[model samples]
Target: MQQYRNKLLGKGCCGTSYTQVTEELQELIFNHVNREHDRVNEHRGSETNPEELQELIFNHVKKDISQSEENRGNLRMTSGSRALEKHKLPSFKNLIDLIIDDTVFNNNFLQMMGGMTSLQSIEIFSSDISVNNTLFDQGICKMLHLQHLEIWANGLMGTLPWCLANLTSLQVLDISYNDFMGNISLSPLKMLTSVQELRLSDNHFHILVSLEPFFNHSKLKNFYGPLPIQPHMSLKELDISINSFHGHIPTEFGAYLPMLQTLNISRNALNGSIPSLFGDMKSLVFLDLSNNLLTRGIPEYLATDCTLLQFLVLSNNSLQGQIFLTNFNLKNFLYLQLDGNHFLRKMPDSLSNYSLEGLYISDDHLVGTLPRWLGNKSCLIDIIMSKSHLEGPIPLGFCQLESLEVLDFSENNIIGSLPSCFPPSSIKQVHLSKNKLQGQLSDGLSNISSLTTLDIGYNHFESNIPDWIDMLSNLTCLILSNNDFQGEMSIRLRKLSQLRLIDLSHNKLFGHIPPCLNITIVTTAFDFVFDSHLVRIIPLREEESVEFTTKTISYSYRGRLLAYMYGIDLSNNKLVGVIPYQIGNLVGIHSLNLSHNNLTRPIPLTFSNLKQIESLDLSYNNLNRKIHSQLVEL
Candidate 1:
């Protein structure tokens, strides 16, 4: 056998052959393992009493095994094991708490455990949970250790268990988003000195009770959601939205929630001006009283005091009067939606200082020119002042606002040509219709490649249509109508393939109508000729006879002729030529007045085509031949 020492030192092997080294190594391994085992056993023996240690380990394992067995039994019971017999159940005398959040409402379990003296917390949150008088009647008052309880979203019916008032140890209670419908009295919660959070939102609680208890509860920090009207509450966050709460905003609201950081009283019929005391709530960060009848001007004191506010929405209210920005110190405002108010007049000048990213003042009767100070708000992305009474030219300063994306001043009194300096790269729509403006269309307008709709109609403008208008590739609606303009229609107009409307009427323009105009989406009422005047009458020539044809004739002779075709009044002109026979081709003609023109011959027989003629006037023409039968009526 070879003896091998565990130590790392150079030493001669103790009487062992190399062939037997393998067996030696195995023996050494066995010996080392045995030694380590012995050492561990010795350490364990010195540290703890063996019997006590064994007992502790056995108890832990046993407890785990028992708990597993108990869980198995509970699973069996839940799985509809043989109906639990009341006598088979163990006594619940030591039960200190019970919480059930499932479909299993064990009636026998409740009956057996209701009398437990140490039962403290009773929390049942389930869709099937039902609350009745029987729970209280069955000795629920015995709960002594109950410090906090919450039963939410349960389909519980009937009044809250009256015995809840007897739970002196309760510190918190939440029975919200449930089907409970009844008068809620705070008397039961008055004794809960240790309560910190109470939530009863979305419940059918309609009665008003004394709130003095909640007001005095020093530890209460959150009393939120739907709540019955009470004098006051010691809350840091309160929400009474979506309720039938009416009457003016309670002036003491801020006083009661001195530490409140959020307060939402929206969706209520709350009326009257905002209470000035709201300015005292220094801790408030979010205040939403929207969707109410709150009237009068927003309190300047509150706006200045709530400098830390991030969201202050008072929309859909009767709030009126100018927003006095000088008094407001809004440094952290992110969203301010004051839309749907009947507030008239200009926005406060101090609005230029607001750092609002999203602002909506739509549907307000805001009047006067759009404030140029708006350009100072460099952070504004969306500004909707639609349906307002804003008038005058769009401020040129708006072109400087590079951050503006949605700028809507539609349905307003905005007049004048769109600013030539308007940023061509950013503007999307320029709607300036139904106003009193007079100017040639801006040649620089073609620079706005982003333009989608340009409506500047119903104005008095005298200028040729800009040829550059065809450059707007994105243009969709082009409404230029009811104005004073002249010149031949532009051939370039045919290039506006995206045009949806084009109206040009009631102007002085002459020359052949552009043939390309037939392709345009245009609706016009144009008079091709002006009223005629009188010229000197001339003698008839024996060699030339009166001629009529379908075509209009220009006379070289200085006299007027009276022949019926289409009615004509070329009464005064230097036009000279024999009336061609084509004039009589106008069979639909009703009247004729070539009366004050140059010399002409006897009336042609082709006048028989004037069957529809109603009036004739050859009075001032030079004619010596016998009158024809067509002239008998004259």
Candidate 2:
């Protein structure tokens, strides 16, 4: 029996050589198998017993015969370790579903699954599957019970197999992100009436098709693909973005899908005016048709019907005409972005009444004064109307809004001073640059402790720097360049601990540059200049000789390296004092514009200490001596 043990476990047990086992050993093996089967059956009730358990035990004995045969094949192929032989067949056959994601496939074991009939779901994603037709033709079509199919392989090409349409129980179909090239027809999916959600985004499926048949499906809720000429029947949500569909939106399209709530048709070549019939969709809540060639005025009827609308984005289009809401009811609206359009005239007055928290209406041809009613909106927090053709003074009533935080009215033709009574406490940023506002800056501006940024550059403000301007300790950016402000340099400006940017260029300011001014702490592009009128002050030498010079005195201030300060410019001033050597202590200066000034003596050799200086413009100055070679190296 011991001699026969080697032959029984070795090759050819089921073929030419059969090693008979001893009766004593056979009885012992039979007793063990019977006891294990009885123990497993005891746990499982006889009514709903797992029939695969008995088959698994029988298959375990059959594995020994199959493994011996595999070894014979390995020996015939080549000489190697017997234990290293490939598995020709897998014993476990009760697998109802198998999913291998991002793995390699072995052909030897997969070919033995010809008897697997219970496989209901098979997903092979991101694997090294062959791109040949023989791979799909093997036994994939034979899995008749497969209802949920999702394949993410680069091998699938040409037309999909017709047998896939036979899966009547299929509820969700997603065949996207593949290289399947050909005209996609839904005729095969006609039998799959139970399908509820179909996603075909990012595919080569082009050409418009009438999806009228899918309208009758009771469970169909989501249909995402190319837009169809005929409307869906019962769809609740539809997304057809990034398609080449052209022509006008159907007028009665919303009539078919009364349950539809979301409609996205952006990034298409669709033309013509928005259909007025969209007002009939009482259930519509979200509508996005941006990035299209749609022209004409926004449909006035939509504003009346879409009372429940929360989000409406129609930017980046050729939409023209004034915004007029005759019967608009946007009380529930939270986000309204309608920028990047050719809208003419003024913003609709009705929009000011809405309880909007975020509103974007920039980059339009809108021409008119900013409505005073905008300040009345207590709920508005972020209001951006930049790059518009707005004119006239900002409404004084804007001071009434205590909730307003971010107000950007830059790049407009707005004129007149900012409202003196404007509530500066709630404002964090005020962008009133590139306008024609004139008059003295309000002294009350310094009282706004919450004010961080105040940009009033490119205006006609004429007056002395307000004494209270330094009271705004929280101010970070103060840009008042290209104005006509005249006075002695305010040394109190050094008290602003949080000052990041200070641009006072092209103005009328005089006196010696403040040595305590930390230019390296500011972060914004700083361009400071002394007043041109300062050039009139003539400096007297020790001999009491009057030295007449038209050029203004100028000096650049760079801050220390460790400090978070920005560079400073005190150029074009009547400053006639000697260049302070302490000015070289600023190591973080990036730019120094001290041109057209009445400075005396040679350039400061200490200026060479500014290692971070990117530009140094000290031209047109009243310096008597030649340029210092050390300063010229900067």
Candidate 3:
């Protein structure tokens, strides 16, 4: 009967209140309770033995025989979308639980909820909900019996109500992952002494700090938001990153959150030195303060006191000074990010003691040779030191690291050929661009079939582009431009069918464009969907940007833009002869640049088929012909 009522509600019950609740429905509920009582009464008058009569009475008493609906409630359920489609004001007449799951709710449903004074718990995780005003007006403040109320991942708009203090019996109130607006306040919280857990995370609320009252309150089961109050001693984690929070961290914050194990306040507008009071916090395992305007050196306490630290990210700040002076006590650390800072120092030998898995210290003013102890850190995976001052030979000991994945030393003065022994099969992306590297790579390079991106552009390598590169069949991006490689373009390049972005510009390669250069993958800038905000807007792996030329201009592609970008650049190379008609096979390629060559021929008439071409450059070449008319269709 409840299921039948639900289907009826989905079909017709847009918004019906308790006053307007169908009399039939109300009668049905009352009859259920009355019938049970009548059955027990009739059993008492029957010709049954004492034991049978007592059994009938006992079963009725345990079943719907309580004094009220609140006492009769017992079930707790977790249902998916099927349980709640397009209904409003479905009744849980027992008043101990509400019929809640998802979708729109009108004033009638909220008014109905508020009228249920005996209702003890209600969880509403709806979609596209718009609670345009505070909950107080909805009369939820009247639910004095509610002990737990959760509204997670709902598009709940509007501010919370001070009348929430009326839920004196409320023990847990989780309203996280909603579009809740306005300042988070304790005006209502101060009176709700029974609230054991109040989760207000993943909401867009303004900041105001007045949490000193909760210092010793002991009821906090973890609080998160942009509240910059002194942390409570029991709080374990605080991740208020990716907000518009400004100003310095609370001076005595560490003193309050002494027991916190995780703290991520990154991507805010915080400035000034990291709090020295952090020395008081020794239990920290994860601390990320990156992408802020923070200045001054890292707190010395992080190196000396927080030995339990596992991940420390302080990137994209104006912080200066060496990371540590001497005794670095972070032996348990696994990942460290200090990029885009002014830490003008050498690679600290103290780092070798920790079995770190990731080290990103790029775009700094550091000076040193590749540390030999890198081989000792068997867990090492990524090592990005691009645009630094580090200079020297590729350390042969690096070859010993079995877990190496990304090795980027681009824009540094690191010289010498790849050591014959320095080829880790696990390597995926290698960016040594704009360096002084020259000479032969080890034969072991042929085995790295997993290599996806290899950008060694603007280097001093001179030779035939190695046909051995063809062995990396999975190569997606191959940028070897601005090198003195004198040869006909490797015919083997035709084998790299997965090649999406290839830049052999400013090289000495002389030959006809590879006629079979039919690259796969097609997308256009105009219609390129920026994978919705629910998209991986920012990848977990630090922002990896790639520079590619399109529309005869260099553009930096990051995030999803990089994922959908496809182009080709072979300009300024000594290539010759007619452009291949097979170039038309690249119907979805976004850019094509073959300028500054002595090629004398008409543009490929087949190019009219390119529906996704965003850029087409054929300057400084001896091409002669009218453009294909169908090309205008793009």
Name the candidate that leads on lDDT.
3
Provide the overall lDDT of each model, using Cα atoms, as 2-decimal numbers. Answer: 0.55, 0.60, 0.69
Better of 1 and 2 by lDDT: 2
RMSD of 3: 12.2
**Which 10 residues in a row give candidate 2 its minimum summed lDDT?**
540-549
Scanning candidate 3 in windows of ten residues, the lowest lDDT window is 51-60
lDDT of 3: 0.69
List candidate 3 segments past 4 Å from native. 1-127, 130-155, 161-179, 186-204, 213-217, 523-540, 632-634
**Local lDDT at 8 for model 1:** 10
**lDDT ranking, high to low:** 3, 2, 1
Q: Indicate the residue-level lDDT of 253 in model 1.
A: 62
TM-score of 1: 0.45
Which has the higher TM-score value, candidate number 1 or candidate number 2?
2
What lDDT is obtained when candidate 1 is compared to the true structure? 0.55
Where does model 2 exceed 4 Å of error? 1-230, 233-253, 256-258, 264-269, 411-415, 467-476, 495-501, 519-592, 599-616, 622-634
User: Tens digits of per-residue lDDT for model 2 on 135-177?
Assistant: 3445455556666555654345566666655667667665555
**Which parts of model 1 have CA positions greater than 4 angstroms off?**
1-158, 161-178, 186-195, 226-234, 393-407, 416-634
Of 2 and 3, which scores higher on lDDT? 3
lDDT tens digits, residue span 43-86, model 3:
11112211111000010012222233332232111111111112
| Candidate 1, poorest ten consecutive residues by summed lDDT | 54-63
